[model samples]
Target: MKSGDMFEAEPGSANRQEINPLLKLALELGPLMIFFFANARGERIAAAFPFLQDLGGPLFLATAAFMVATAIALAVSWVMTRKLPIMPLVSGAVVLVFGGLTLWLQDETFIKVKPTIVNGLFAAILLGGLLFGRSLLAYVFDSAFRLTAEGWKKLTLAWGVFFVFLAILNEIIWRNFSTDFWVAFKVWGIMPITFIFTLAMVPIITRHNLGDDSPQDP
Candidate 1:
């Protein structure tokens, strides 16, 4: 749901190749960084380009950049892996559609609320999977780590609820505050919060780890 939801190559079964961690990180975060920078320097950017002024405003400009960056990222992923990672692909598709609407309608609101839609979509997916007795989180994360079935269920629930919370938070911030403030929060705030939350999950991960005690490569 979040931009940080970087995908790994499919689970090793046959000839699938692994993606380099650094490359994956770049593909995941680079577009977001570009968007944030474009947003912060939008006036200067518009002044230089002039064409961007016709796009409506700084947020719109950033949205356009975000769309392009997302497409590039997905393309690079496909080139490196010869396959699209489902999660990132889904996120990228949302970016393209919502970003297109924002540009077409000249309404910043559509782009501003993109995260809310993304997070909510992920929450629904996870919860819907649970209803069907499937642990979709395990599918998304199985390549990264191993976990017991119960562990997968718990993790899926936690992540689903967290995603709902993020959707709500995005709605609150974007609707109630200035675009600059929202952009700053997206760039400076969300990643750190997500990183901290991930770190906090180490205990849960350890508790649910479904493997031998011997050290293994991540």
Candidate 2:
């Protein structure tokens, strides 16, 4: 399975047109990283700046900065590609909307539960796509693997289920854990769990390999 076809890359700049996965991850995760570090250094920063003490706490400062950083990232991506990624666009829009509510209402719960809403929406999109005889997950994984139709169907189902699982996990984390723990898990836990889940699909991927001997490239 060639990894090239999944990306709807522009001609002549196929390499540059599509953002690299790792860099994309960084952009998506950068704000959260800033939040975690800001929370960790809030006291020091407050001591140095003095005025930051009015922001209430390190956590508050972190959330404010996260909002700014996320907005910046989306802006940069929009500028570079002139196209918004489906998942990030959805998530970023939710962030802006809910982040605005959180700031406006001065209640952090809105931001805390944003993941739950996002995951639930993704699960619905994938599951509903299947119901409509469409596998929207293809748009995401297509960039990474050129699997056969059967592989795509199976993989899409797997992703749909995985998203449901993530929603449940997020619900549990936020419900049972402290705000700090939830924030930490949001940043550190999701990527590793997703990477592991992606690796776990290797067997199905192998079964639908679509090898060099099977089909000649046009």
Candidate 3:
């Protein structure tokens, strides 16, 4: 199957609802924010909920909250759009699985390595698509912008490498750092780094843009 088929919404659907960019951002970030908050205030939350203390500690509590929040986010997306975006769907699946394992095993390691698995999977899919001469990244961004085939290939390669970098970074941090520090980095550090990386790609997007009135190059 094509990488786009795995990670992007189906192409050329007449009834597909377009999500507002701001709302999309909120949906994507909301679960992570909840996870961070739950971790930071685990004691207070457990005091209120009481039963959550059985889950073990802050990371475990955060994992449970993260799983619930992720489910809610995905459900809301499906209700609004009648379809789930593939990337988020994949990530959410990981969250649920790892989160469940963390809770059941009473081991924080499962949840801690979740990002590494997700990012590595994404990198593999993107790079593997290129091996088969498909620029699957185009499908993911086609709604937002248009770029030449060459541009898509370049962008895809950049993103694939970035994902690998993220996976490695996650491994390094979670393995070496305190759970609190790791959680903080996952929430604050990664998001800003991703945002900055996106901004840095502006030149590539502009250079490769298929303009509003211009046809794609043959």
Q: Indicate which candidate wins on TM-score.
A: 3
Candidate 1 lDDT score at position 217: 23
Candidate 1's C-alpha runs over 4 A off are 1-12, 212-218
Best by lDDT: 3
lDDT of 1 by residue, 4-98 (tens): 33444333334445578778889989999999999888999999999789887788889999999999999998778666777677789899999
| Candidate 2 lDDT tens digits, 36-91 | 89878888988998887876577776767778898888777766665556667677
Q: Which residue pairs clash within candidate 3?
A: none
RMSD to true structure for each model, in Å: 4.9, 5.5, 3.1
Judged by lDDT relative to the true structure, which candidate is superior, 2 or 3?
3
TM-score of 3: 0.90
Ranking by lDDT: 3, 1, 2
| C-alpha RMSD of candidate 2 | 5.5
